[model samples]
Target chain A: MSLQIPDDRTPDGKPESEQPQWRRDFPIDWPEDNYISRRDFTRFLVLTSFAFAVGQTWILAMGSMGRGEDRQGRELVASVDDIPEGGAKTFTIKGTKEPFLLVRMSENTFVAYGQKCTHLSCPLIPQPEMGRLYCPCHEGAFDLQTGHPMMGPPRRPLPRVRLEISGNKVYATGVEDHRL
Target chain B: MPVPEHLEFFIDPNRCIGCQACVQACAECDTHRGYSMIQLDYIARSESPQTVPIVCMHCESPTCAEVCPADAVKRTEDGVVQSARKPRCIACNNCVLACPFGVPKMETPMELMMKCDMCYDRTSVGKKPMCASVCPSQALFYGARDQIERQRPRSRPIHRFLFGRQIIVTKVHLMVPFESPVAPMDVIAAFRETVIGHVFGPNFSAETMVGGGK
Candidate 1:
């Protein structure tokens, strides 16, 4: 049987025989292959560098803008009579989706805090009898008066939502962002 | 030269109670956007309520990064595997399917690949990952190799894993019994057989187990 060689040509349509000896002999072009690989790698590195720079710039911009823009000031959450002493009510902040808990500690005293637990963002339930906010998932407890982590794995205090009493209305105004 | 501080995470499946504290804490990660990257899976519930917490193992040669057509997945200089770059991610799910540990998940709504970055925001500052912080049980432990080794002497930290013929070296360490080289496999087998006496300790009753039904 006669040996048949398949016809292959360069991108320019030049026949194998018509090309330079180096090009014909070393069709794989190891040096060129290496160059292309290095080029791609360099390109990737440059792109990555650009991405990092952009990320840094974005972080800087966000930092400069400040987190205050998201804070809602003086939003009515509940009335004094809505919750009895030792009773708690959950309310969502106005103009935001954040949930806050309002607890009436005594006849005249009321406290409010961001509903999420400091340790894991678990919705905290107020244990009126224990005088604490408890995370059922891990039994993490926070002092009802201060929102300070009392027991369990939580190390940080719950974010205290500032409350204002006007006549009989309890308004959630500002928040103490102290994270324990 | 002094050994580099390669802080690896050690997960003890036997200690995981599946309370989902880690999952909740992971979502609270500053950069996670309230999305949890950690997963708690029940190894066996019928016989025993044993669970395993799965996070990004952060392999030395991460297959997720290698398979990403968009080059979105990245590994930090410290070897922690990061989530896909939101802008560059094409939501192809290549990394999701390529990950050996099944860590990466496609956030369909955002069309981005999300996975555990080992709470890099906190870890970079020398703080433990969120999952490790609120684990309650010492299932997820993150710290310097020497410190962790001292705390739990019986279980050795292992970074090498064998998948068929391929040997994968992970940046995150897995705690396995000191006597076994194939720790993960052995642990799984032990769990399947419900050999709590061997895995845990002598007091291996249901009442003794965390969150176990008596």
Candidate 2:
């Protein structure tokens, strides 16, 4: 019984040492047994630093990309009678779940606010008596008039969902943001 | 306004209604810049306690800057400890560990460090910090150290004393007497006696009060 040894050819029909050129210099200068080099470690640290810097640069770039918006024609939403003045409706626009409240501050006027609480994504409930919107999950409250927080855990004002009137129908055309 | 030497936020508990305005403002600013400045945490330490807003206190001597080996973090001239940028970070958790407030965080995968700089950039440009600007209750304020100190609730105690401690007072004050029935003649007599007594008292009241005041 004779024992035979196999050569260093990879099972995939390629020489084990003949990988792509990019990999040739990699492991850069790994010693015979050790898997990494000091140079490689330093390079890794430098690259990490570069990555951090690049992340900031990316942020500046994104900020300079400007805000995403378009001034155009309006879109149709619920009818005037559908919301019943001091009520809310959840709808999706541009693939985002935007909940808005339709408040009848007067007989002929309507105000709407994004229903999501600014605190922790809780849904806001209307407190008509208090003229505020309350979040049951966290007791967060927002003013119905300016969408500012009246009390509780909400910090930012509710993004005012723009509403356009088309004859007998009320439409949410877009949102007006005060955030810088 | 420039931040002070010691970075302590004057939280007006009276003005705080638990509205997370500062939280959303911070998150928005962070999202705009593609970084995380502030985040809302819902801790259930008590079964039914309401979630409260928390933010970086921006300490005077920041632990984040102390522990950063790469020196990527630094306190700005305006007293904000700002990270150079996300790409400058080395993914070391030293800053996170050094922060006594535990406000700094490093996200997974890339593990980039992130924390608040008190919106120093925005403030330097004459805009209010994101949190202070977005506060619906005007709870958060930004200004020069002195201005903020002045704007702080007036009820805080004045802990400083004027002049040296070796001064002594030779005079004393006496109560004045009133003609009304609620007042007494002894009070007036005591006042006159004290007035005369203080003029001839053991300590130098006139000199001491003068230097002590101004």
Candidate 3:
């Protein structure tokens, strides 16, 4: 059966031959035409709404699955004496290429955070003398103790990398989800 | 071809590196008194380290100038939109509310409307604006329209924009990726998927929104 609909115009309307160039180029029955009936448009809208729901559901499922996997892994980053007091060491996570910094603030205290500055993701430099993490790109500074922004542009605290110490070994447990 | 006497300033977001050199240099403008008008917005620093700088577009029919009840905002002969004059400014935020690009800010304590003037103090004398001069990444560039277009063929500098029903022609040009022209260009729709998110996103860190914690 032919899918093309018969055009019975030209009774009072413009004749087919005399129609505008745009109308001729894009014929009423063009195969790939975007035109659709009101019912079809409504149906397409409903399908689109359904598709968005399904996509969001899939994302939610994937996010939950990823979170479960995240809780299972713990990577050893450095030893207790690997970094001296008032020093910093940079290391990548086991599966991720992103680097994290470990700062030994004092003899007994060690803190770790994502090396990317909160301002613009420029690599941060630990200023041991000034007791802060500094980003040279924009003069962004973060407090060494709490990893909170203390000066310049950065407002968000550096994403803290959860750390555990046992028997002279420093273990990077997991990244804390600051959002939750 | 001779360069146009009134050269148009253009910015390419693709080249921006988020260094904030432009922001620091803007403070050096003689009249602004250490208040920088340039804003470096992090597009998606969490996902990627992309940034786009925001400055006054200097529209052909400036909404700021039109909305100013006290006749404080003025456009120069060369088309640079000046900030609200301190003496005549009524501290009414009509210009701030009317600006489609969200470029103006009301300094509450000072009771004055302030925004990017394209460094009129320097540009009037044929000098480059502070931001364009200091931008290390060359994201902010100032040159004649013909020269700039010739140098960067991949991107086209566009000043005319169609937003819904309004047609806005700007003095400052935005470098947009080349696309076949078939209809009136909607700059807002183009920005909606990219620049708008960075500028208007709720999750934007406070520092990125307002530089240096202010």
TM-score of chain A of each: 0.62, 0.58, 0.59
Cα RMSD of all models vs. native, in order, equals: 33.8, 38.2, 34.5
Q: Which of 2 and 3 is the better model by TM-score?
A: 3
Task: Show model 2 residue runs off by greater than 4 Å.
Answer: A1-180, B1-9, B30-36, B40-52, B144-214
Model 2 residue B43 lDDT? 35
Q: Which ten-residue region of model 1 chain A has the weakest summed lDDT?
A: A1-10
- Cα distance off (Å), candidate 1, residue B198: 25
Would you list the rank order by lDDT, best first? 1, 3, 2
User: What would the per-residue lDDT of candidate 1 be over residues B134-173, giving only the tens digit for each residue?
Assistant: 9898799987778878888888877766554445567677
**Once superposed on the true structure, which residue ranges of model 3 sit more than 4 Å away at CA?**
A1-180, B1-6, B180-187, B190-214
Candidates by TM-score, descending order: 1, 3, 2
What C-alpha lDDT values do all the predictions have? Answer: 0.75, 0.55, 0.74
Over the stretch A7-46, how does candidate 3's per-residue lDDT look in tens digits? 2221123456776665444332223234454677899999
Task: Note the clash tally of each candidate.
Answer: 2, 18, 0
Q: Provide the lowest-lDDT 10-residue window in model 2 chain B.
A: B166-175
